[model samples]
Target: MSATDKKQKQAVIAGAGPAGLTGAYELLKHTDIHPVVFEESGEIGGISRTVRYHGNRMDIGGHRFFSKSQRVTDWWDEIMPLQGAPSLDDKLLHTTDKTFAANGPDPEQCDRVMLVRNRISRIFYLHKFFDYPISLKWQTFANMGLVRTIEAGCGYLWSVFFKKPETSLENFYINRFGKPLYRMFFEDYTEKVWGVHPSKLGADWGAQRVKGLSIFAILKDMLKKSFSKKENIKEVETSLIEQFVYPKLGPGQLWETVADEVRQRGGEVITETPVKEIHVENNRVTSVTVENAQGERREVPCDYLLSSLPLKDLVQSIRGIEVPDEVKRIAGDLPYRDFITVGLLMKRLTIDNQTRIKTFANRIPDTWIYIQERDVRIGRLQVFNNWSPYLVKNYENTVWIGLEYFCTEGDAFWQMDDRAFIDMAVGELAKIGIIDPADVLDSVRIKVKKAYPSYFGSYYELDRVKEFLNGIENLWCIGRNGQHRYNNMDHSMMTAMVAVDHIAAGNTDKSAVWSVNTEEEYHESK
Candidate 1:
């Protein structure tokens, strides 16, 4: 289809997130659609926003800009240049006295994103740092000890020779790493993240995330790294990626820029507008009723509608249509994992060695440390300064860390008052030997609902829901929660790209958009 021919249709997008924004950008650039985007939150990025708190900016959860898709990488580079810029000598730079000034350097004005080379992330369990993805190293041996290491090796060999059928998340992990390794490295952390036992969770989530990786592959890759000269092997799985790009301020900068470019191209981007009612007629979405922050309702009519709202919410909110009772029940039952990020600002501190006390300058260099310790409720800890110099208000001796807690909305932890929650988080940090409670200068807590789509027992019902939604000719669901498919940031954007292509070509192929990350092989070469 010609670009000019695509100009006649008006596209209305729900949620100005990565997928919705990418869809709008694609439509505005290739076609003259001039799409209108509506974001329910006050910010542009949905869960991906870089929230500001007391002169500091931090992501809700660490969002690394790594993807195995070249198209997605190119799109990111087009939006925010990740190269051809002078590097900032972060080591030489010191925190200035004006760090806490109200008027700080604005990331939007600079329009910059730092392409961080490679950062270390280790599992902190049993007072030992184990390399993530289970690398063959002395520290791993020292942590597991000789007997446990031998047991792990035998377990892997047994699983390789006698494989079991995969049925649940437990089976998925055990099928790859054997029951021993799965119980040691995955059991507690996985349960903490999902709030469900692995045996009850569906295997689809595991396949989408950690598939194409096994004990054999890890051993083979380790041997090759020690002996071979060839590099950049294509078979390496996504979980084993060592390096990734990140925005200077945070991921919000990228989506915020996309919103600005869309406006510059004569497109409308509205925030704090949530679609409350979807009107369907003749098996097509005709219009939607939205409510603003001021409690004003307005009807937005459009020829084509792209939505990034949760599939359950979208299915339940449609009016003037008769959705199947079974579909509604299944969709509504789809679980979600909420998130809370507690940013703790601490004064200059030091950890004492046996001989003498030393500064925390380079003591812990991990961007984020996975909490494999089961006692604490905190699942992970992100060192904000480690992610980027711009993230922390002061880069010198001061420190900023984000404690991530995974919970369901309205649960005991989620419903805890901010002050109480802050206290609990600080106490936990002290308990975990991360920091002293007295050293904390200030704290801020941010709660995000439906941050992760949980793959529960009802996840298989999503196929039926997708089949039903596919019958609607004018509506397309795209994004992580939009499709309930635990897609990475790149996979989410790729879905929008394909959705735009389908809309422009006047083709009805929801399957094409849905099939993006379902394949077993890497879609892009290094």
Candidate 2:
């Protein structure tokens, strides 16, 4: 094969998640590169897709848009065009001057997404239903005696104050919130989500989410806010410490716009084209094998390959491959729980305290009802209407509840018929008093396998999987499943940006791409 037989220059992105699409678009925008993207789902959005239930639209779960990086915001704002996107004639947000009591705001950060969209969210005191954070203020009265709370409190203070570092999520939180609060707020829900005890789970994910949150931070904030509450105190900005940007529609609208922009920019986005195999030769990823919904397979060759598909699934799909047994074993050991959403549309003209669902707080039905109450291994339920008002259908009004269940491909929950699954969620949720069967108008179910990547103390194993991909030239892995890291959506997209930059430089390092999960640098336009 001479120059005449050489393939036209292009890149292939497997999966339409934020990372894959971002990589494709960044390559097109920043380099003289072209790309073809293959997505397994006919729908563009992955975990962020919007689905309809009884004529009402909802996200996979309750997804919120809150990124500090301007690069992310630039891409998002440009595509979603948040400055003047579509909107409901009657804006859905209700402002509470009492909740957003900050003396002043940066005006700039608070100006873009929310201001133009006319969406608003702030705090609300719910019948004094629960404590602010799992704190000693109430743990002493809840069930544990003063002696116990005092002992745990002392341990927590010593743990953090003495710089006695904790290496796991259980130890980190156990040392901060004390065992009771950790048990109450996080333990049950996480166990339901990961299908494992909190102790077994690594603290890295915990720290990234609520790291540096000490017993002191909670206690100090509680005291200060308590005093300030009588006086009223609130902070509003676009900073991480302030307001979070939200779409008028569900979060999927962001990806939808991004997909449109990619198409308009001459990039090919082929949804429903599941990649079947990655054909390799002499340690190079020569081409990709893909199958459609009807199961016709074809190989597409490209200059580079940026994959956001699952690490294990990608590994298993290699043809004429010669990977080491240890790497294969590591990939096999990587375990993750897939999730399905039972979205229940309700007949309410308005759900009570609708805006209070913004925070991941307890009470107010916005709270995740840990399914530990029943034999069901279901995870938490997200009220989709809580994400944005554009989700509701009409003045008819609605509440879109996402009941999540952890499942393997053919397990009990996974095998359930749609009707059976919805019935089960309704029954279990009603038992918890979070919802009533009578209020439900209609329902729809979406099963997304391998949504949340589980971190099961397998970083070294993940590295082995990484090694296998590293051996394949012109291939980079990005996103949660691609690297098997529990990175948030923003972190995953950032990884894609870095990968595309390297592609522009004619370099392909799988390891370098995986390491882009935490950097905060903005992608300055050249």
Candidate 3:
């Protein structure tokens, strides 16, 4: 067909998260297809969105922009170029890093720039800091004490000789890190995050989340760092990466920028509008019914549908289709873990700055600290000032931090009022000796629904739901909740990219989209 005679195609995308926005951007860039993205919430990025309170910004869950995929990194560069000049923190500290792009925009003068940041995350157990992934250092052994260290060494050797079958997450950790280390480090934390024992969870979570991380991997990384220069260490595992890039403001800044570019390029991004019903005909999606915040609903006709909605909701939203009893039952029984981040603006923290890394006010240099204290219900803590000096309004005078808690929706923790929850969070921090409740100047609580897709419940039977969803010719599922998989930010974007590649090539098979993060060796190398 001639260019003028060709029929224009429209793609309806649900959710304006990394997956949906990526699908829309790729469609507009690669083809003549018109894309319309609908977001259920008022914000652009889902869990990746930055919440603004007063003059400070909060990254819902801390996102470290480090990816092994060149395609993903290149795409980030296209949206927000890396900083050539020093950022606020770098300029103040008079630091120089090799990751900075030459002849790019300056973060101090320009807002659309990515800053290279040091990654330092440690575990706080028994009122001390231990390297995350359990580094083999003398201080670690000292902190662990003589008896526990001996037990850990013997348990690791035993694990190396006798491997347990990978049937559950508990077994997965025991096989990799040994029983003692797993019990000491992974046991309580995993339970806190998922609200269930590791034995009840599937082993696939370990394979995907912490693929190549183990005692041996940590040892190899230590040896590599000792033998090679910092910048030349390319084979380090993802969990052990020391440096990553981040937006000047936060992760939401990047997504909001992408949303703007989509609009400038003849695409539509409607926020606070959710797809209520998806209409299918002849085994293909034909239209979707969307309802806006004003309670008005309208049908949007489309040639294809790219969905990043929760799989349970997606399966329930289908119309003019006969979902099997098994599929319906499994979808309804799917479980999710909700998250709450309490952003506390404090005058100062009680924790001392013992790390060699210098900060503006000699504060803790950790971007986030994993709380291993069994006494407190708080799971993790994020120091926003360390994430980016630009994130905090008063980086020099005050401290900005986030306390993360994982709980199921409608539970006691989730049902608490904002003020009460914030108070409880502050008290927990004080109890953990990380902060003083009196130092908290202001606080805000942000809750995210379906923040984590659980590996338990009907997750083992997810393949049956996928089989049914894949049967629909014009529907594509992408992103964490959409596929009911706990995918990282890059993996979610890659899923959308793979789906777009298939659509652009006129391929109907959806196998590649579902296989984004499935390979064990690929993740290890990446």
Candidate 4:
């Protein structure tokens, strides 16, 4: 077959991120639609790539997804499988920080699940979820008699009764979590993560994420635990909380596997090939033009195309794709706060136990201690050793302590030299007594320019943009950047699957792809 014939037969994929790679893997396995993945970065994993830092392994912003789908879990096993994964029990010891003892579960690790008591043994708590699943028992118990709990209750009542019509996150959170929790637990870490006030974020995202758990739920959990009432079947947070999984190495392993499988299935995954222009013809996506590292350009075409590139980008290069200038203006207008992860490879197996911080510290989110009080750039402290011990080196045990910093794309922190960033992290860790700077074996930094999609209550405009793009034929987009959605890894990969199924079935549907972060069974537009 000629080169063009071969290219045409193979489905051309844009971006080697998880979504793109997942689509390529399933498509190749289920159909003859050989998929060729094109990634802008030289590396395979997108936001989830694993970095070997100072002889230690680390991930970005502790980006592993613990609460997720069985389908995604099964697919991961098919590719990278958790060969060296430590048992769930072993994982517990790692996550227990002093903050956990002083406060509660970190929002990052709060994948609430039922506590299966070991009748097989002496009924020692199988997993460390307080009151198991909802954690209502633990949350209320920890904050008992504290004014903050009453304030949070008032926040909820204020939200429910006053019913703030405001849609921005700042208003939503203030209404629900009260100013104390919002300022203490959310403010600085949020400002560092998103470079915006929690108040400025859209409430819709908050609604979708932490909507189910309420003061009422907490009270119920407390009563149940007190009476030792046996629930026939423990109903965990069915809305979003449940048992979750992660890659043994790190979340990055999943995307890396998909990229590997794409090539193994006779398709191609070309990394570092940035698409300069997405060529279009007669309202259909004809091909994508890419540039190699040497500043050379090449064009590849396909009858079908799946894009995980940003929507504003796709619409800008294509004609007859009626993305209104106003709409495009709004879409382009969407902004994101960049994130930098300062991964510290310390000599110890865990952080110091003397910290008075709580797991989800009111001010610092005791889970990831937010050093907001200090003028330092370190935003949140992630005890990576708590996430998984396998990422560390040596049988003696190691600690992967991370600090999350926020910045604009080209700002000081984002542009800060790697060595300097590492130094800054070690300094901050020492100041907080979380780590001994001398004990820091080494550190590394990974900067994510588009780590989060900032919601400015302009989601209506984004929705309009989606509606416009949905009208097009034979072209699809999915993923965090792909859909401009604030999605965790699981939701993003699921978007890729929906897009793939659409093209494979020769049908047209777009809703299913964006229908994630909600407990809904989505289907391709037919």
Candidate 5:
């Protein structure tokens, strides 16, 4: 066929989040395929979306833009270049260790820029702060009393000598950090986050999220830093990364920029429109039915379908396909954890700045604080000021913080009224002595469904579902919810990039897309 006579191919993408946006951008950049993206909500980013309320912005679950993949970092730089000049807080405080491009955009003057931020995350347990990975320091030992310290040491030695089979997450933790440390640090907080005991959860959860993070790794890192120059030390674990890059406004700003670029490049990005049905013919996706907010539905034809929707929803939306009964049961029973982030704009924090790190108003320098106290239901606390001064509207005067809570949808906590939920969050912070309830100025609550894909509940049998879906030659699943795995932001992008690579090369085997974060050595070496 002549070039002029050839048909123009169309690619339909569901969910305008990282994976969908990345797929559309890659298709436009590399292939001749025209792309159209549909998002259920009006917002651009999914969980990574920013919520702006009363001049203050909230980053839903605290996205730290750090990746081990060079391609991911380069992609970010291409979208929003890093700042050359210091940001507002950095300039005011004269911070010296931050990395800045020589001639990049100035964040103070430019709205579209990325800021280099310090990573300071810790654990709050027993009314004291400890290093997140259970650092070996005098203060840490002090916080954990002498008796507890000795017990932890003995338990560690015992674990080293007698390793248990890693069948459950509880066993994984006990084998790595010993039972004493795991009980003291990880047990309660993990249960709070997943609403299940560690003994019942699969070990894959630990392998993926907390890979190679253990007492031995912590000691090796400390020794390496002690001997080698800070700049010379490389290959640190992801959990031990000290610095990361973040968008000036928030993560959503980057996605919004990408969406605009897609539109400018002749690609269509329609918001408030959700892909409701998938029409398959001869084991291939040929069209998708979408519904707008006005209750209008239309079937659009496409040559390729890239889906970033939840696995359950995706399986249920398929038409003209004989899905196996086992696959249907597994997809229907796939479990997910919901999230709630309570943004509290306070005059000041009651907690003191115990660290040496300098800040705008001598506030605690923590991007995230894992709440390990069993008394309160808050899983984590995020200080927006530390994430980026631009995130908080009144950076110098007011403290913008987010309190995270994990629960299942339609539960009592999820059904609570906004005011009551905010009140409960504030009271929890007060109860934990992290804040004084009276100092709270204003509050906003945001809820996200299927925020985290759980490893339990029919998840072990997900391979059958994947095999069934892979039979559709024109369909590709790429993202956290798409794969039903707890992937980081970069992993999700990598999956989409891999799928686009396959599409461009006419390679239909979907194994590469599924193997993004599953390799043991790939995650360990990074």
Candidate 6:
């Protein structure tokens, strides 16, 4: 790489997300190429951003900083060092909420960078809590009586003896967890979340989501844990990890620090800039046109482009790029799941005749609970206070909880008023016996469009679109939506890492980025 090459090299990245920001930071570290990041929203993190209201902060979707890949872990540590990470006992565990914030009066005591926390979660179905990994506890057996347990065991044996062809999501779960457990735990909840029956939805989602875990494997692991007192036992599954690392303020703190570091290293991070058009010549992306907050558009020339935008939006923006008709069709047809998080503030939550006693801002032990009951449309709920003490305005009396609903952009839930949505969340919470209506204080609603790149009808057509994009050597799709992948935080960052490596090594192998998280044994979190 000569001076001429360095002078001409400028990588313009679309979307200042984990992937895009990671690519920019890596480019600055490894090469002399000037990288510029453009974010469509006022915030930095995509779905990972922490929404702050008053003095409280909430993770858009609860994120745990645990990755199987060491490279991803190292990358996270580089931005937010966990060497001297804070522990529960380090500095006053049961302290009041008056002691924390990003910019508090006493900054030293309220450092908002690195912290490790415990994780406990379960499925709430039929007003009963079941261990996520389906442990063989006596309480579990009692909840699901002896007869039901025998039925489930028999179903498992039958499935093993006569394996059915796995075609739809229903068959996929049945093959792994058996029919009885699948119907009891997965079937209806999945249908409610995706707005489609398991028999109608594609099995690809199940394949990617629960790749390595099976009923037998979970039982074996639980038995081993229950019997052994060994400290050396490692959690091979992310979902089963007892603890994880996190930013004190929330996940967004890590990315915000990354953005600042990128700027310090002579890189530009422009927020409120939406990509309007991508200009291509001779099958190579030459420039990108983006509109700023005031609706003023400008073109930025590029030697290479890394996009973290949704695949559909990315293709539609390629008007001047002359994309192949087949690729365009596939991109247009790609489906996505939008999300809404209703952040509710409450005085206290009492369940089962016991007030939720607080310890370090946690009212309950579980960080989040999967709502598997058929009655509520809310798929999951997050105990924001458990995630981080800094997330709540007051830890003693006030707590924040996030009721998450998965829906399409134009759907009824999405279009519902904030007041109605809050009321609905309260109604569901009351219906499930999780919280009391009178404890509610105030609420905030955050809607995210295309939050999940859905694995649904015609999702397989994305393979053709990916193939077409790979042919455009200068353009690389390198994130969750960028590749239409349901990648975890680490996997998303890994795609960007691989993409930047390709440019650094002077290779044209875009497949290296596309091949991420495609393994049958690869589950994003689990």
Candidate 2, 146-172: lDDT as tens digits: 665566556555555554256666777
CA lDDT, every prediction?
Answer: 0.80, 0.64, 0.89, 0.61, 0.89, 0.80
lDDT of 4 by residue, 1-526 (tens): 7755763356778888778888788788877777878888887778778776644567676553533366765665566544343354243343444543334223234222212111100000111112222234344335334675677556556666665655677666666555555654456655666666776777766666555454455566557657865542224433322223455556665566667667777888998888777666676777778888888998887777787787667667565345577777877777776788877766662232422333221211122343544355676566554444445553133456677777888887777789977887777656655567777776667777677777664556887888777776767878888888777676777888877777778778778777776553221100
lDDT of 6 by residue, 30-85 (tens): 98889999999999988888888877888997898877677777777878777384
Query: Which prediction has more favorable lDDT, 2 or 5?
Result: 5
Give a tens-digit lDDT track for model 1, residues 53-83: 8878888778888776778878888888875
Please list the residue runs of candidate 5 whose C-alpha ends up more than 4 Å from where it truly belongs after superposition.
93-109, 231-234, 521-526
Against the true structure, candidate 5 reaches a TM-score of 0.96
How many clashes (backbone atoms < 3 Å, residues ≥3 apart in a chain or on different chains) does model 4 have? 16
Q: Which ten residues in a row have the lowest lDDT in candidate 4?
A: 119-128
How large is the C-alpha RMSD of every model relative to the true structure?
Answer: 3.7, 7.2, 3.6, 8.2, 3.4, 3.0
- For each candidate in turn, the TM-score is 0.92, 0.80, 0.96, 0.78, 0.96, 0.93
lDDT of 5 by residue, 1-526 (tens): 8997999999999999889999999999999999999999999988888888987888989898887778888899999998888565576445432343122223346568788887889999999999887799999999999999999999999999999999999999999999999999989998998999999899998999888789888998888888976643237877887888898888999999999999999899999999999999999999999999999999999999999999999999999978888888999999999999999999999998988887755789998999999889999999998887777766656889999999999999999999999999999999988899989999999999999999997999999999999999999999999999998888888899999999999999999999999865322111
Query: Alpha-carbon error at 444 in model 1, in Å?
Result: 1.0
Per-residue lDDT for 212-265 in model 3, tens only? 989999988888778877654346678888888999889999999999999999
Against the hidden true structure, what lDDT does model 2 obtain? Answer: 0.64
Candidate 5 backbone collisions, by pair: none
Tell how far residue 468 is off in model 2, in angstroms. Answer: 2.8
